[model samples]
Target: MKPGALTPQDAMARAVAFFEHLEPAHLAALDLIYAPDARFKDPFNEVQGLRAIGAVFEHMFATLDAPHFVVTGRVLQGSTCFLTWDFCFQMRRFKRGQQQVVRGASQLVFDEAGRIALHRDYWDAAEELYEKLPLLGGLMRWLKRRARS
Candidate 1:
């Protein structure tokens, strides 16, 4: 309990606020909520360190239009938290104006210092993303239809 030290509760609140209010400018301040060597993994990328993690977010901003997260639910226990959210964005390449939503969840583990040590995202790339693409959408639908019971 030192001056300016964050408790786990504070860190969780900060993490949620950081994500919900994230903007390009906030990219420079990730260290406030993440450990220097925090690991972030998703269906498409796995990266460690603040710089690398920031790059992943940067890439998202670069490739997608109006990308944002809407937190739906959360569960917290000890140093871990699970957050379910909807990732909404417009595909810059294909569906330019239409907003796409991908339901996902993130498991965050915080360090003793209250900074996120690990962030792993769980989501189905095929059903959530690929099924919305151009040529791939049709193929994915067909494959799903064939697999259904």
Candidate 2:
């Protein structure tokens, strides 16, 4: 497939489908969604290829409970599809630890095959995640309130 021939709507749909399959542990389907040499970037990891991509998901699933992606909105132009997504899940740093829910969005660029070539996420790590953790949440919230005033 050629990049020029791919429609934005089609690309968006494919991207959504990929996320839909991601829920409830569908590691096997990753190969179908990501290209062999695809590159993925997030706050914590910079990975290349399907194997590395799969490892990212694997780490998430291992650490987080009920991890899922909710597609809130999508915009497509040329080969780039900007997706507003909420990745919500309960995560704990260790067993018997308190769980926290984290949310974020990603802007993705697709190739001719509708596979993601570049995925960049946008969200405030301090506000959305770190601020919500147990001990850190209290300190972060206090800082935020002080800053606002």
Candidate 3:
């Protein structure tokens, strides 16, 4: 790690902490960590530009209850980093306050400034999200079983 520069580990750590403590107030602060034209993608949506990225997080807080990310592991290689995380939260519209955990990972690409250029998340939406819901959960589980050989 250099003296004043943001190393890959430092960036990952900062991101982990940021997500763990993220609130609606810190949406603007994303500009500090992500490039202006950054690309962010997950299983459900793909967005480019920091404002669009911020809107994603904003929607998360608006739609979920106390949503947070717990980073379990990190691997850094060159300008790309992979972070395994546990997304823990409760559904605001369904399942009430019961805790739900979605295990997933993210691929982060950093530029010369150490700000994220691309943030891609990989997870099984059917298993991690839909299968945890009430009505959808049952159908998802059934579909999973049907799809299995």
Candidate 4:
């Protein structure tokens, strides 16, 4: 089927599949999944354009070890789709050998061409990631404890 023929859910599924084993070479083909003007945002970065979006993934590959995403749930409404996923990876420098998992969700909006126009990821960096580190984890955990009733 043509790209434009895909429903929003199909497009979201394709993106999910593509990210499961994301590699640097996949960045070059992002245009097939994302529109040229696509805007993407997550806890650490916010960028526009497919090239910039590709840069984020490139940086991810450079800074992490075997980073990948597994979609766990999907909900579709009109031209928008929400996907709950588990982001798995190992820190390249810190705690270098253990696998880490961050639970999160993404909101995606598809353009007329069925390419993703907006992709925003939602997750708590402190809770899902920072608290998993060795040094920062202690401080973050202490902070969390102090804030609780």
Q: Name the weakest run of 10 consecutive residues (lDDT summed) in model 4.
A: 1-10
lDDT of 2 at 82: 77
Candidate 3 segments exceeding 4 Å error: 1-5
Largest lDDT belongs to which candidate? 1
Q: Using TM-score as the measure, which candidate wins?
A: 1
Clashing pairs in 3: none
Which whole-number lDDT from 0 to 100 does residue 64 have in model 1? Answer: 91
Lowest lDDT sum, 10 consecutive residues, model 1, at: 1-10
Superposition error at 131 for model 3 (Å): 1.2
lDDT of each: 0.90, 0.76, 0.88, 0.89
Model 3's C-alpha root-mean-square deviation from the true structure amounts to 1.9
By TM-score, how accurate is candidate 2?
0.83
Give one digit per residue, the lDDT tens place, for model 4 in 1-149: 45446777778778788878688887889999999999999999999998899889989899999898998999989889899999999998888889999999999998877789999999999999999988999999999999995
Clashing pairs in 4: none
Query: How do the residues 109-128 of candidate 3 rate in per-residue lDDT, one tens digit apiece?
Result: 98777889999999999888
lDDT of 2: 0.76
Instruction: Note the clash tally of each candidate.
Output: 0, 0, 0, 0
Q: What TM-score goes with each of the models? A: 0.96, 0.83, 0.92, 0.94
